[model samples]
Target chain A: MPVASLREVQKRFWDSLAGAAGIVAPELADAVVSGTTLGSRARLGIYADAYASRLIDVLREDFPRVAALLGDHRFEHLAREYLARHPSEHPSVRHLGHGMAPFLERRSDVPRFVAELASLEWARVEVFDAPDATPLAMDHLRAIDARDWPHLHFVPVSALRLVRASWPVHELWAGADPARLAPATTVIRVWRDASGAAYHAPLDARAAEVLRLLIAGAPFVIACEAFTDRTPLEAAQAITALLARWIEDGIIARIG
Target chain B: MSLLPHLGHGIGLRPPHYPRVADGTARVDWFEVIAENFMIPGGRPLRVLEQARTLAPVVLHGVSMNLGGSDPLNERHLGELERLIGRFEPAWVSEHLCWGAYGRYYAHDLLPLPYTDEALAHVADRIRHVQERLGRRILIENVSSYLTFTHSTMPEWTFLAGVAEAADCGILLDVNNVYVSAMNHGFSPHAYLAGLPPDRIGQIHLAGHSDAGTHLVDTHDHPVPSPVWDLYADAVRRFGPIATLVEWDDRIPAFEELVAEAERARAIEAEVLGARRQLA
Candidate 1:
């Protein structure tokens, strides 16, 4: 038999592992030396099994809420499908589930909230190691002149993320009974505290609108318009309360 | 014989012991971290790594260089590794001799290569390129394998030695992997050690393996097994007092327990070298 080139051998070996049943090509199988206890096919199967098991473990860690809701068997099945469709492109396994939420969104077999829940979980994973920044203190906000308050813009910390979903995913994420929940649009702010701990909280309608404006780089006066339902004096009070909360939460990185 | 420093025994820094590392209580000779894990922009892992470096000398051991793969080298991964080297200033950097990625897809496992002339030349060239990019020599560790290719022209040890010599790099001799692959491939572990150029051995890795009825799996979940320890004694006799690390990736135990394992390696090395001197 003619010797296969290095490239050809790699392609065949990869195909066998990536295939549905780990069926090694005859040429590739012939290339392998069968041991006394394990044949060439079985030896190759070890790699196949490890490839799936290792990746599934990574997915389980990244989306524990989704895995818990779906149960182990169903989660494993969905994860295998996800892997087949979208193999890891990143060198680090940390980025393995980058496409998972979108993939679940396209599927109808899972619950309606599963996709949103996945998005929320992935956001936490990203926020866990996104980047490090010195959070802007409340003193920075106080230093701004009253006349310039309307034009002041705030920059969010690098670890901050705002997730908007049609379903109340935060409730599910918090271990709320999925069966007792209804479809409700929610905006959740996820960020890492100064001590490197991750946290998330659902925003009320007014606070959500204001945070959205602030995250979009809107000036303080424009973002305060989210309180249009209140009087001018009341809106000023609401904006002050929200700014204090955001500063305490360590979500704002800079105010200028 | 190695140009690398003879740092004492150490353990791989894992997340379960991050608090100990942060609080300045975890004590060991050094720490070996996965390079890709710390290649990110920021977060707790990087912060922990910084703390670990301050506590003890840290070395960067990578798993995804894919030096033997058919695809083009990943420049972005190299760039990140280079930046990490600049920031952390690890004692030395190392990666596996096997490949893990192909054509943009990563298997995330140390996939073995056939020991043919073609593979030898390809991997040697890739290692040279990597050394040029990082501006330093790297130690390539041998991975455990379940099978071997019939079209190969050489043994695993010869291929490893050839690559290290041709690329002018060092070897991160993994004793447990040698035993595991030797058991799986029906080769003699002693011959595997004897074939290597001793001067090229810059460091050593000791880990546990699972006894699958047919073959052993390099799981690194258990304590360093008796046989692997025995092999480590032999490695000490051959390589002298080289830097060694205990690896426990899965089912990681408490920090003290891991450090105790490193201490055990220290004891064994002392025992072996002491006997050698007495004989002399």
Candidate 2:
């Protein structure tokens, strides 16, 4: 091979390596990095086997609670398949296996509970590494008066994420009875605070409405309008109560 | 380009221990930060990194240098890296001896490279180019590989030391990875340790490993195993107490737990320093 052609060969070698890692394909494994084992063909299987196992180990570590619920046998089955679909896009293992949820959702063999559980775990990771921000200080909100409230802008905390699912993922995530897993439409909020800690909160209808408005950049008065029939003060009190909780959790960044 | 004489042991300042490092509570001499985590467009990663920088001297360790790749180096990643160096002004920059992305496809894991003569010349030139681009020589650390290439001409340690010498860079000797690779490949761990050129070394990495039946895995999620710690002590004796660090990436206990790990490294460094003093 020409000296210049070596670079092309190197590139092809890496592509084959990634393909093998994703699918545990024997042919691809033979072309990339591998160790010799028992038989000529059997040797490449070592890389395939090792590749899947390493990724499975990473996924299990990242989603231990989910793994605990699914148990080893089922979790390994799902994790191996997930590894075949998502071969990692980011250099950090922190970003690996993020596509497990979509992969789980697409699989007919995956129980509905499994997909929801994976979604919740994946969301937890997303929220954990979400960027940090200067949360809305109490004084910053106080600066906005009722007159300018309609024009007020709001910023959601970097950690604040609203996830709605057909199943109670939060309940299932916390070691709840897997036997009791049932479809219950729900919305949950996950966020980290100024102090860099993560929290999960189940949203009631009223709070969820308020959160929607807040996320849409609505002001205190306009956002309260969606609550209906309540006086402005009532709405203010509800919004204040919710804001207090968010502020305490370090979720609210600033009133825009 | 190089660091001030390494102040002995340090810790991979992970998020779990961020608070302790940020508040000056962790009794660590120094900390190594992952360069990419802080390579965001803008936000808290930088803020926290700045806070950590204030606590102690920081070293920039990266996962995406793709040192062994055949493509032109990722100038975008290098630009981000340059900005981070400007902001944090890290003592030195370091990356693995393996490649990460090939073309646009990134494995995310440190993929092994063939240690043939062609690859050595190819990677050495790239390293020299990177050094010129960054305006400073950096350290290249060895990565643990599950498999070896059939085309490999030299042992991994020889290739690693050769890369450093050829590129005029330094070596971030990851002792745990050396031990892990030794176990996986059925090589002598002590021989691997003894073979490294101590003068070419800039830093030391001491991390935990998961014990598999046939081979040990470099998980960096658990506490340093006893045998690895023993090897680390031997490393300290050979390298003369370079800037050692404890890396606990997953199953991060508490801030105090990491400090306890750092404290363990401190004990080893002290022992090495004390023995040297006695000999002197």
Candidate 2 Cα errors over 4 Å, as ranges: A1-50, A61-65, A111-113, A178-182, A219-221, A229-241, B1-4, B15-19, B37-51, B145-147, B155-157, B179-199, B207-241, B246-280
Winner by lDDT: 1
lDDT per residue for candidate 2 within B2-107, as digits (tens), equals: 2347755678877667666566676667879899887764444566788877777889999977888776788888988899898899989999988777655565
Candidate 2 chain B, which ten residues in sequence have the lowest lDDT sum? Answer: B1-10
Least accurate 10 contiguous residues by lDDT in model 2 chain A: A34-43
Q: DockQ each candidate and list the results.
A: 0.88, 0.24
Clashes of 2: 2
Candidate 1 lDDT over B1-280, as tens digits, reads 7659988999999889999999999899999999999988888999999999999999999999899999999999999999999999999999999978866899999999999989999999999999999999999999999989998899999999999999999999999999999999989998999999999999999999899999999999999999899999999999899999999999999999999999999999999999999999
What's every prediction's RMSD, in angstroms?
A: 1.0, 4.5
Separate clash counts for every candidate: 0, 2
Fnat per model, in the order shown: 0.88, 0.28
- Residue A248's lDDT in candidate 2: 67
